[model samples]
Target: MRRYVFGRLGQVILTLLIYVTLVYFLLQAMPGDITMMYLSNPKIPQAAREELKKQLGLDQSLFMQYVSYMKNFFRGELGVSFSQYPKPVWDILMEKLPRTFVLFLTANVFSFYVGFVMGKVIAWRRGKVIDYAATVVGITFWTAFYPLLALVVIWIFAYNLKWLPLNQFIDPRLWSAAPFTANQVFGNMVYGAAIIGIGIFFIFYYLLRGLKPSRRSRAQAWALACALIAAVLFVAARKGMLIYIWDITRHMILPVFTLTLINFAGTMLLMRDSMLETVQEDYVMAARAKGLPDKVVRDRYAARTALLPTVTSLVLSLASSMSGGMVTETMFSWPGLGQTLFAAALSNDYPLATGALAFTGIFLLIAHFIADILYAVLDPRITYTGQSGV
Candidate 1:
C-alpha cells in the first residue's frame, strides 16, 4: 500500500509539473500581452509603454519568465492581475473561492446521497410503479443539457410560478435593509440545539445499535456530528451575520436546485444498474437461500457489492466540482472561481487565467489519486499488486 501510495504521489508531482509548464507556455503563445492592456490610451508614450513592459517582466525571455512564475507559485503568489484596478491574482481568486467551493460541495453531497438512496430503494423494488417512475425521471434529467435544465427550472419556479428568486447571490433588499432581530437569533439557536439533540439520538441509538462498529455506522455517526456542528454555526449567527447568510441561502436555492438536478440523474441510474447486476450474483442468491430476509439480502449482500462503481463515480464528480460549476455559476451570476476565470480570459489576464486552469488540473489529478486509494477501501477484492489497471 505504501509503495503504491508513494509511487502515485511521485506521479502526481510529475503530472502537475507538466500541467503547469504546459499552461504557462500555452498562455504565453496567445496573442497580445498585458502591456497592451495597460497602454490602451492612444496618447500613452512609447518609452512609458516600454518601461511598463519591463516592470511587468514582459521584456524577459520565456525561459526566465517561466522560472520567475514557478518561484512565485512556490511562494504562494499567483502574480498580479493586469486588470484596470490591479491587485494580486491570488487575492481576487481567494475572495470567490469559498462561495464556489460551498456551492459545489452542497450540490454534490445532496445529489449523490439522495440519488444513491433513491436508486437503491427503487432497484430493490424493481417491477413496481415506483421503480418505473424513478427510472423514467432519472433518464429524462440525465438526457437534458445542464443549462437548458437550469433555464427550465428558472422559468417555471422563478419566472412564471414566482416560487423562488432569480439571478442575484443575495436578496439585495433584505440584506441592505432589515437585519436579524435578537428574537430571531435566539430562536435560531433553539432550532439549532433541537437539531443537535436529534443528531445525538440518531448517532447513539440508530448508528451504534449496541453492536460492533462498522464503517457505514461509524460514517453515519460522524456525518451526523458534522451536520450538527454546521447547523449550529449557520443557525446561531448574530444579527449582522444572520441576514447575509439568510439572503445567500434564499438566492442559492435556484442554483443549488439546478446543480442537484444535473447531478442526480446519472448517479441514480448508475447505482440502479449496478445494484440490479449485483442482485443476480451467486452470492446474493446464496444469501437468499440461507434464509436471509429480503432487505438484508439486498442491502448487506447486493448493495454493498454495488457500492464500488458509485464510489468511483462520486470521486470523479466531486473532483470535477472542485473546479467550480462554470455553466451553473455563470447563469446565476454567482461570484465564484468560474466567473473569475471567465473574466480573466476576457480581459487577457494571463497570470490569473493560467493560475485558475492550473488549479483545475491539480484538482482533477488529486481527485484521481484519491479515487485510486478509495477503491481498496470500498472493496476487499481490490488490490494494487503493482498492476497495470491502477
Candidate 2:
C-alpha cells in the first residue's frame, strides 16, 4: 500500500508540473496581454504601456516567466489578478471557490441519488413500460442542448411562474441590509455542513456496523440521524444564518435543478448497463437460489457491484466542483470560479486564468489518485503492488 501510494503521488507531482507549464505558456500565447485593452486609447502613451508590461513581467522571456511563476506557485503564491488589480489570485479563488463547490457538489449528489435509484428499478424491470419511459426521458434530457435547457427552465420557473430567483447568488435587497458579508455566511455554512457530515458518518458507522436491524429499529436510527442534522440546522437558525442560506438556496434552485436534469441521465445509463451485466453473475443467481427476497438479491448482490463505476464517476465529478460550470454560472450571473476564469480569459488576465486552471488541474489529479486507491478497497479482485494495479 505504501509503495503504491508513493508511486501515485510521484506521478501526480510530475503531471501537475506539466499541467501548470502548459497553462502558463498557453495563456502567454494568447494574442495580446492585458495592456491590449488600452491600445486604442490615445491618451495612454506608448511609454506607459512599456512600463506596465515591465511591471507585469510581460517583457521577460516566456521561459524565464514560466520558471518564475512555477517557483512562486510552489511557494504558495498565485500572483495578483490583472483585471481586478492588486488583488491576489489566491484571494479571488478563495472568495469564489466555496460557492462553486456548494453548487456543483449539491447538484452531483442529487443527480447521483436520483439516477442510481431510477437505474436500479428500471434495470430490474427492463421489459416494463416504466423502463422504456425512463429511458426515453433520460436520453432526451441527456442529449438536449444544455444552455437552451437552462434558459427555458429559468424562464418557466423564475421569470414566468415566479417560483425562484431570476439570477445572481443572493438577493441584494436582503444582503445589503445584513451586518456581515456573504463570505462570512458561506464560511458558517461550510462549518455546519462539516459538522453534520461527521455526525452522519458516525451514525451510519455505529448503527449499521453489525447485523441488520428490525424495521422499527431501522426507522429509529434514521430518525436519530435526521434529528442530528436538524439540530445543526436549528443552531444555524438561532444564529441568524438561516435567512441568508435560504436566500442562496432559492437562487440556487434553478441552476441545480437544471444541472441535475442534464447530468443524471449519463449516470443512470451507466448504472443500468453495469447492473444488466452484474445480474447475470454467478453470485446473483446463487443469492436468488438461496430464497433471498428479490429486493435483497438485487440491492445487496447486483447493485453493489454495479455501483463501482458510478461511485468513481461521482468522485471525479466532485473533484471537478472546483472548476465550476461556466454556462451555469454566467447565465445565472453567479460569480464563481467559472465566471472568474471566463472573465479573466476574455480580458487576457493571464495570472488569474492560469491560476484558476492550475488549481482545478491539481484537484483533478488528486481525485484520480483517490479514485485509484478506492478501486482496490472497493473490489477484492483488484490489487495494487509496487508496479501497476491489476
Candidate 3:
C-alpha cells in the first residue's frame, strides 16, 4: 500500500513538472516581444528599455530563468505579477481560487450524487417512460454547448424572472454587515468534514462487511482516521458563518445550476450505460438464482463492478473543477482561475498563467491518484499488482 501511494505521488510530481516546463517555454515561443510591449514609451532610449528587460529578468536565457523560477517556486514564491506589480502571483491566485473552488465544488456535489442515483434508477427501470425521458434529457444536455446552456439559464433566472444575481460571486453588500469573518471559513470546514465523514463511512461499509480480519481492519483504520479529522473540525466550527453562507448560496444559485446542469447529463448517461451492462452479466443472474435479497444482488453483485467507469467520470469532473468554468465564470463576471488566466494572457503575465496551468495539471494528476485510492478502498479484492485479490 505504501509503495503504491508513493508511486502515484511520484507520477503526480513528474506530471506537474512537465506541465510547468511546457507552458513556460511555449509562452516564450509565442509571437511578440513582451519587453517591447511593456516598454510602450516611444521616448524611452533603447538602453533604458534593455535595463528594464534586465530588471524583469527577460534578458536572461530561458534555462537560467527557469532554474531561478523553480527555486523560488519550491520555496512557495510565485514571483511578482506583471499586471499587479509588486503583488506575488501566488497571492493573486489565492484571492480568486476560493470563489472558483466553491463554484466547482458545489457543482460537483449536485452532478455526482444526482447523476449516480438517477443513473442507477433509470438503468434499473429501463424501457419505462421515466427511463426514456431521462435518457433523452441526459443526451441532449450532454451534447449541448456550455455557453448556450449558460445563456439560457441566465436569461431565465437572471433576466426574465430576475431571481438571481446577474454577475460576480458574492453580494458585496452582505460584507457590510458581517465582513470577512473566521466564522465563514470555519463553517466551510465543518461542512466539508461532514461530507467527508459520510463518504468514508460508506467506503468502510461497502468494502469491509464480512471481510477477513486484515481487510476489515484496514477499512476500520481509514474510517477512524477520517472520522477523527472531521470530528476535530466539526467541534471547532462557528455557526455564525451560516448568516454569510446565505449570501454565498444566493450568488451560487445561477452558475452552479448552469454548470451542474451541463455536467450532469454525461455522468448520468455513462453511469446508466455501465450499470445496464454490468447488471446483464451472468453473475447477476446467478446471484438472483441463489435467492439473495434484491438489494444485496443489486449492490454487492452489480453496483460495485458497475461503478468503475462512473468513478473515472467522477475523477475527471473533479479535475475540471480546478480549471473553473471558463465560459460560465466569464459570463457571470466571477473571479475564478478561468477569468484570471484570460487576464494573464491579455497582460502577458507568464508567471501567473503558467502557475495557474501548473496547478490545474497537478489537480488532474491528484484526482487520478484519488480515484486509484478509492478503487482500492471500495473494492478490497483489487490489488496494487493490477489483479483481483482472489
Q: Report the poorest 10 consecutive residues by lDDT, candidate 1.
A: 181-190
Total clashes in model 2, counting residue pairs 3 or more apart in sequence or in different chains: 0
For model 2, the superposed segments whose C-alpha errors exceed 4 Å read 205-221, 316-324, 383-390
Encode model 1's per-residue lDDT on 1-390: one tens digit a residue.
887888889999899889999999988887888767756698889998998889888898999999999988878888888773478888776666666755676677788887888889888888999999988887788678878888899999999999888786766566455565323433454456557766775676553234433668767778878888786776446335665556666777888787777778777888999999998899999999999788778777888789889978887788766654787788888878788888887777888988888877776788789788767766667787666555
Worst 10 residues of 3 by lDDT: 206-215
Winner on lDDT between 1 and 3 is: 1
Which lDDT value does model 3 have at 224?
A: 79
Model 2 over residues 1-390: C-alpha lDDT tens digits? 788889889999999999999889888889988999999999999999999999999899988988899999989899999999999999999999888767877788888888898999899888899999999999999899988998999899998999999999999999989977898888888788778777876666554344353567668768888998899899988988899998988888888898889888878888899899999999999999999889988887889789889888787666644554888898888888889999999999999999999877876887788788767766667788876654
| Top candidate when judged by TM-score against the true structure | 2
Quote the positional error of residue 304 for candidate 3 in Å.
2.5
**lDDT of model 3 at position 173:** 73
Q: How are the candidates ranked when ordered by lDDT, highest leading?
A: 2, 1, 3
In model 2, the Cα lDDT at residue 236 comes to: 84
lDDT of 3 by residue, 206-286 (tens): 444554335467767686767776565454445455556666678888888877777887778888899999999999999
Kindly report which residue stretches of model 3 are placed more than 4 angstroms away from their true locations once superposed. 38-45, 181-239, 290-296, 385-390
